[model samples]
Target: MPTDQIDIERYHQLALQKQKEHRLFLATLKRKAPKNLDKIVQEVHTEVFSEIDCTKCANCCRTLGPLFTEADITRIAKHFRMKLPVFEEAFLKTDEDGDKIFQSMPCPFLGEDNLCSIYDVRPKACREFPHTDRKKIYQINNLTLKNTLFCPAAYLFVEKLRERV
Candidate 1:
């Protein structure tokens, strides 16, 4: 791994240590996020990402599955030149919550080097994973909090936010 790359093991360990603080921080964020929170977060997102490369650490793709929407199914199916049902049968299964997800972890579309096989037509959820730079930064505090456990960028974003806010 690169020196600047986040080690998933260390990230999780630190995340556990900071869990309570993170929860309290998020609660405080929900109560009153600064007006420029989104812009500041976007800047942090960009800065942190400069040193963090997703290709080196696809923990999100290797761990949590993306929610596949109907459009995602259609687009991916079309990209594969297969019938939708055929694609679904081959690559998808509904989770306990009835949400369509990839049938396996280390997502089938993930290449050996962590590149996405179907990058262009990947699900909307995949496109938005981590979501640190999204608008209305305060609105997604809960989701952001959850992501910190699995996404290094989110972890870094929240850590950086702590200093700025």
Candidate 2:
């Protein structure tokens, strides 16, 4: 299916309803997931991403900005020619976990076309959004489950993965 034509809100609702089932399914995979699952998932991810242009659906950047690591902070600050403290004061804030995140949603770095203004130096978390191809997929099963709601590709990936496993 073409991701641009996907009904995001409908999928979000469906994903919410399937959360428990998905979790249990992931747990089952924790023990039984193929040793080559990462390679398989990578292939799926490539195919899915080819069909889905992220620039058309920046839901992840629009809804949940990435958590910034210290390195991300330094790189971004330098990109803007600002000091870390200055950058933080202007655009970042601490989350409940004390991790640095954007001060606002629809991230400040996100352009009108859903492209990242700082794409080259984006946070590691942003680079790895909807981490479907991460090795030892079980390690990030919970995160992947959460991603399914906002990311059409993730939702489809999980559905496809179910069939594969």
Candidate 3:
């Protein structure tokens, strides 16, 4: 990988590729979710994190637009004391067909070091990011494909999890 040209745009592309691999792995998990997602998530995270440095690959926060729910939108809007419509117009957009997503990939709120500008009040999806680390994540099996390739942490996490079962 070329590290020199990693502006937001390049990071965005790298994020897409990571998401792709995650999706591929998720398909295999559909057949079985190993019985213990928490421990599995932890073990895999241990392995994955050893290989990841969010500072270096902020691709997840930078590229993926979280699928914030109605409640999520309201909470975020209230956090900023901005009306929902205003917040939506300024930062969010309905993804291609309809689902709500951020207007830009490599979120505008990303800082010089790729930190989230709204960390404390980030959307629900943002808080549980890489949902692979979430407890009983198997409950979200319905959403695996979309989320699988959505972040590098998720991609590597899923790979390690799959290896266990």
Q: Give the TM-score of candidate 2.
A: 0.92
- Show how many residue pairs clash in every candidate, following the order shown: 0, 0, 2
Instruction: Give the least accurate 10-residue stretch of model 1, judged by summed lDDT.
Output: 1-10
Clashing pairs for predicted structure model 2, backbone only: none
- Count clashing residue pairs in model 2: 0
Clashing pairs in 3: 19-149, 62-106
TM-score of each: 0.94, 0.92, 0.67
Off by over 4 Å in 3: 1-29, 135-150
For residues 87-164, write the lDDT of model 1, one tens digit per residue.
Answer: 999999999999999898989989987899999999999998888889877788789888888888888888998999
Writing each residue's lDDT as its tens digit, candidate 3 over 1-165 gives 447323444434554665655555555555566677578777787787777666666767766777878988898789889999999999888977788898878877789776777888787877776666667666675465455444556555665676775
- Stretches of candidate 1 exceeding 4 Å from the true structure: 1-5
Compose the digit string of candidate 2's lDDT tens values, residues 37-124.
8888888888788877777778898898888999999999999999999999999999999999999998988998678999999999
- Residue 64 shift from truth in candidate 3, angstroms: 1.6
